[model samples]
Target: MTRLTLPSLAALLTLAACDAPADGPVQDPEPAERLATGPLTPAGPAQTVTADADVNLQHAAAVVELDEIQGQGTLTAKLFGTAGGDPAMNGLYVHAAFFLSPAEGWRVFRIGDVLDYRVLSTGPGRVELEIDESVMDPETSEIGSRTRRMILGWAPGAEGAPPETVTVTPAQ
Candidate 1:
């Protein structure tokens, strides 16, 4: 049997609250305003997640239901990431999987090398993520530490299709 500690129970409650559907569409108050700051702690201790992709888990995994975002249905979104690849290709990699209700498995998406990410908005069938990434110097073809915004949207259908991703870079 699994033992539920106070902290784990609290986390479960918080996850439940987040998964709950709102009365209507949810929106971000501001473009830069963050919806949630940190990832929700899973019941168990953080461990390395082995996947088909060659990457190490960077942070604690989070669970969010797509129904809370898109209002489509009860599809669970497992969000996690990796520290990165080699030193030359060091960058945070974000991964998200959608578990379709009544289905036995899930569809995973390896969201490229996002240096950092923020939850911009969620609900109404769409989860917008504002990712801060390092931009390379096009002129010199050298990767620099300069950071910019790369927005990603995950609005998959209940059929478990690929997520709708959009990367937008604001004018500097």
Candidate 2:
């Protein structure tokens, strides 16, 4: 079975960090017209959590914080787990949180209780997260993974309004 060692995983994380936008928000290439959404092609590696862990143990596997344009606020992506029940029930969940103003508070939404997810790319107010689904071989008792992309869009409210919209859709 293939295993992700700490050194290798660290290296991958480092490479991912380098791909993040540094100057400003990168404009999304997709057109504004939303298509008939469905699952996109699976891409990237899977972020897996052992299902043989202790209950009540929580772990933040990955966290990415990006500053949006002046008034757009901040977008944070996290892959975390809180194994409070059965050890076999441990999972890596994906979530996005948007913060505009102190008065507005942070808007949070759960992407999914996926096996894991990777931050594919980020922009001004958008994040592309790849959902990593795990597959198990009954005969071999081995686990494998497949990845599909999803976009988390956080649009700013008009005229500095407190309410903003967050959407999760299959990435093109």
Candidate 3:
């Protein structure tokens, strides 16, 4: 047996430890590329509406009704914007009144008006409204608006009804 010095023993141990296992070639991994630091390129083409597409305005109105009115009211045509050449006639306009209750009195409501009890949504031959109530916060004494949905329909034969004879009912 040969006697080994401390330096030689340490060197041999280092060499043995550094030996790679007999699996495959050892190579350093490629460095990760740095991220670009400027305005980002769009991932895809810009979205656009097709001119030939049959855009259904009725469905859009129904979505707006669900989101806004959620309630309903009967509207009679006291008067409406005349068709043709009138920019205001782009949408339906009607001068109608809402009868909430005998005590509350008959109140006139126009399109887009936020009244004490209701908000009116008017369209060509369509009238809808949402009942609104003011709620008072006990803690901060702040008032907030609360809406209730009413389903509007025509009654079979009710007196003092509109020419269309619509009735308001709480939504199921």
| Highest-TM-score candidate | 1
Counting clashing residue pairs in each candidate, in order, gives 5, 0, 1
**lDDT (10s digit) by residue, model 3, range 82-128:** 12222322222323444545675434433322212333554433445
What lDDT does the true structure give each of the candidates?
0.56, 0.58, 0.44
Off by over 4 Å in 3: 1-128, 131-133, 137-141, 156-166
Runs off by more than 4 Å, candidate 2? 1-90, 100-104, 135-144, 159-163
Query: lDDT ranking from best to worst?
Result: 2, 1, 3
The Cα RMSD in angstroms, rounded to one decimal, for candidate 3 relative to the true structure is 21.7
| Range of the 10 consecutive residues with the lowest summed lDDT in candidate 2 | 81-90
Candidate 1 regions exceeding 4 Å error are 1-72, 87-90, 101-103, 154-172
TM-score of each: 0.44, 0.42, 0.23
The TM-score, computed over Cα atoms with residue i paired to residue i, of candidate 2 is 0.42
At residue 119, give the lDDT of candidate 2: 72
lDDT accuracy of residue 9 in candidate 3: 100
Error of 3 at 158 (Å): 11
Better model by lDDT: candidate 2 vs candidate 3? 2
| lDDT computed for candidate 3 | 0.44
lDDT of 1: 0.56
